[model samples]
Target chain A: MSKLLTDLIEALRCLPGVGGKSAQRMAFHLLERERERGLRLASALEQAMQRIGNCTRCRNFSEEPVCSICASSSRDRHVLCVVESPTELAAIEQATGYRGQYFVLLGRLSPLDGLGPEELGLGLLTERLAEGEIEEMIIATNPTVEGEATAHYLAQLARAAGVKPTRLAHGVPLGGELEYVDRGTLAHAFGSRQSL
Target chain B: MSKLLTDLIEALRCLPGVGGKSAQRMAFHLLERERERGLRLASALEQAMQRIGNCTRCRNFSEEPVCSICASSSRDRHVLCVVESPTELAAIEQATGYRGQYFVLLGRLSPLDGLGPEELGLGLLTERLAEGEIEEMIIATNPTVEGEATAHYLAQLARAAGVKPTRLAHGVPLGGELEYVDRGTLAHAFGSRQSL
Candidate 1:
């Protein structure tokens, strides 16, 4: 193989599911008709890294210190939606009717993986809640074991801080991700939910 | 989403097996830890498109007019191996025991796909065989229906040119790709004989 082809294949293999043969196929496809697309991907990576920042209060991806939702004057300041990742934040945003501010933990409390409250910036969340403006905290962590543990821990933390903490409901598959679940199902899950 | 993030997700979605979720994950990974890798992929795509040319003799990917095997002094001048694409040519080369030169068809004869003998440059292959240096043409096209059709057509072309033509041994798994099969299996497949 030419050095150029070798390098392209190597780089393509860095993708999550692409193996050697698939990477080679992708490299050849890019070499054939998508060189411009490859450049665009590179440019996008650079631009996102340089331009996108974390929301000041929520720790979610944002172009400004306060994300659009957080800056929106109409959103409910009393109801805070908490999530584990920015993708989940995007999903919740896509639901299109939740006019509430958000706080992204960025990760869950996985003790075996050495992730603790500090690692998830729970201190910052506690500080934000201590201001006493927030009336409710909705935990939207995943339904996995880590998610449950994180939600339980955060509930205790919220109680200590004198804030009522609740969790998003979980019953339907929601098409595999809480983010991708249909709006109606999510609305139902949200409406028929029990307090944590 | 920012225009840059949107464009990046769009570009990443073009890759095979990369849906929206995977594209987002890849975009985030590149943003976090693979900036250099993304640049390398872009550079490699540009370089391969600019530098890699088809070998004049076999139509395989090469930096030179003629590929290394075609230019090599020790390779058997009388034996020619035929493949469907440059990737397959690389596979045959990596098997390391094929001391013959190659002929790449670029694609197979798929009537349903409008890929005919003319489209595959079979006329050029016929002309090459008529040069009389090649005593044997090994049909190593994939074991697909289109591949079989292409091999049969090439066999007739070789006959018309008054040169002996043979095919690679079969018993390769149906619909399986040569690139993923191990070297030992490939060697066995290449060694065990049955004429098609």
Candidate 2:
């Protein structure tokens, strides 16, 4: 294979779930079938990187200092949803039609990996909590250890600032089989069962 | 979402098997974490697209008029492999360790899709066979209807030019279960059983 082609394939492996074979397939697909779109993707990536930055207010992606969601007056300023990444923020927005602003941590607290609260923009989160505009902070982080720890840390900060903090409900997912559900999730679901 | 961010996400959807969610994830991954590598990928895509063109000799991708495989003196010029795409050519080269030169059709004979002999580089294939340099032509097109038709068409061309043409042997794959094997493969395996 050509060096340039190989380099492009290798670079595509940096994507979230792309492996060597997938990266190669993506590369060849670009070259053989969608060269024009591939070039457009290149331009889009370049321009997005050159212009888009973390929103100064919410830390989500934005072209300006504040993201559109953060800048919008129609959104609920009193209800803030905290997420570990922009993907999670988007998921919440899409799935639940969440009309509140978001605070993107960009990552969770991983002490072993040297990721601290400072690294996850917890200082900015504290500043937002202290602003007194937010009535509730919903923690929408994943169920992973780091995510849970980060959520706990953020909840303490919110509590200190006299803002109510809430974690997303834990339960067996809709349409999930009991046999296929993991032990931890099943236990959490059992413990959190609702009374009708 | 920012228009730039959304455009990048939309552009990433051009990749094979990438859906909207995956495209968004890829876009976010590029923007949030791998910006440097993302820029490198953009540069690689642009450079590869600007420089890489079809190899005049075999029609595989090349920065020059002829691809490295066709230009190489180390590969066998007498044995040529006909493939439907460059990815298949690469697969054959990797799996079979074949040292023969290749003729990449870039597509198969899909008459229903308006693809014909000219579209498959069969004219170039015939011209190459008529040169008397090729002693054998291996038909390595996929086992689909279009691939079979392409192989049959190329075989007639090679035979007319007095070049021997052979199809890949069909058999039950290595480590495959006989009970799980498809009927067509089982029949082919039985028909082409080898003498130990």
Candidate 3:
């Protein structure tokens, strides 16, 4: 009932899946055992937002201008794996042992939600393709309808720029989030994939 | 990966039903949007711990030495309802038509967990009942086995104190939490009840 308690609970409810009861329980725990914990979380959020900028080359989150993967000479510079968001990129990094560099879209092609090619930074991607160092571009967007549409649009853009484009497999379950899938499944999905 | 971030996530994981994923989500949300919210929760927790003292008469959480309900001139002085926790008391209060005072056990008779009458402040309850203001003591502890045992033990205490001892009706689902039940179901359970 206190203002501080109410605000904490309300703010906790802003998470993707947290509900009112969960928010209350979280607030109670934070209040009871970890005052320092809350401050740490605040710092983490602020630091992550400030220090982790979009990689200039791949658009993945990184403290430097180019992410570690993109900067690494060991990685395959000719192969590029594209993804939607940082969370999704993290999920892919966790699941796959891919040595290729990445390019993050930050969002999918959701015309209905007003997310178009410009919003997804497709112009920059096309410019990168025109540089002609990349031999293959793997569309690792989700298997959702929006992901498919985004991949289709990216394929057209790649063709226009005289670059070869490919997509990740489609055997993943419909409406399934990449984060929920196991590493083995993701790897297997990646291994026996077809070009689209 | 920071120690503060790790500690914050661990602290968030201490809630009743929160898991690693939910805890991470909560930690992120608190960091992103709830800096003020987190501070508020911290303050509330501290304030509740500092200000909420046990009511001398009922052993329930209260800002005053004697809770507002126990000190109220309008509440039924002769009737008292006993519950397992402050959360349960809040639930009953939200049901909103009961004017009787309350006694919170703070815990049930979990012998395996080493909780007994004395440990649960039953001695204070006995001393309070000896004052003779209460004519009836209603056992509203949970319907769990330990709760039943606690109610039975308290009923004996109430009888020995020379007051009418009553128990809230059963059939409100064994092991079901009172706080989660709908208001109508709780009202129905309260209305059509048999003595334990």
Index of the highest-TM-score prediction: 2
Q: Candidate 1 chain A, which ten residues in sequence have the lowest lDDT sum?
A: A38-47
Model 2, C-alpha of B106: deviation from truth (Å) = 2.4
lDDT string, candidate 2, A1-196, tens digits: 8777888888888888999999989999888989899999889988988899889998888898888898898999899999998888888888897888899988899989888989888888888888899999999999998788888888988899999999999989999999999999999999988999
Cα lDDT of all candidates, in order? 0.79, 0.89, 0.72
lDDT of 1 by residue, A1-196 (tens): 6666787788787776779988887876765556677666656655665677787878877777777777789989998888888778778887768888889887899888888989898989989899899999988899887898999998998899888899875665745787888787688777887888
Residue B42, candidate 2: Cα error in Å is 1.6
Q: Which pairs clash in the backbone of model 1?
A: none
Per-residue lDDT of A174 in model 2: 94
- TM-scores for all candidates? 0.71, 0.89, 0.67
Report DockQ per prediction, comma-separated.
0.30, 0.71, 0.15
Docking class of 1: acceptable
Chain A vs native chain A, TM-score per candidate: 0.80, 0.90, 0.79
Q: In model 3, which regions exceed 4 Å deviation?
A: A1-11, A21-57, A61-74, A110-118, A123-133, A159-162, A171-196, B1-12, B21-74, B110-118, B172-196
Worst 10 residues of 2 chain B by lDDT: B43-52
Model 3 chain B poorest 10 in a row by lDDT:
B41-50
From the highest TM-score down, the ranking of the candidates is 2, 1, 3
Which regions of candidate 2 are displaced past 4 Å?
A109-117, A176-195, B193-196
Candidate 1 on B1-196: residue-level lDDT in tens?
5456677788787676679888877776665456667666656655676778787888877778877777889989888888898878877887758888889888898888888878788878888898999988899999777888888888998888777889876556778898988776688788985589
Better of 1 and 3 by TM-score: 1
User: How good is the docking of model 3, by CAPRI class?
Assistant: incorrect
Which number leads on lDDT?
2
DockQ of 2: 0.71
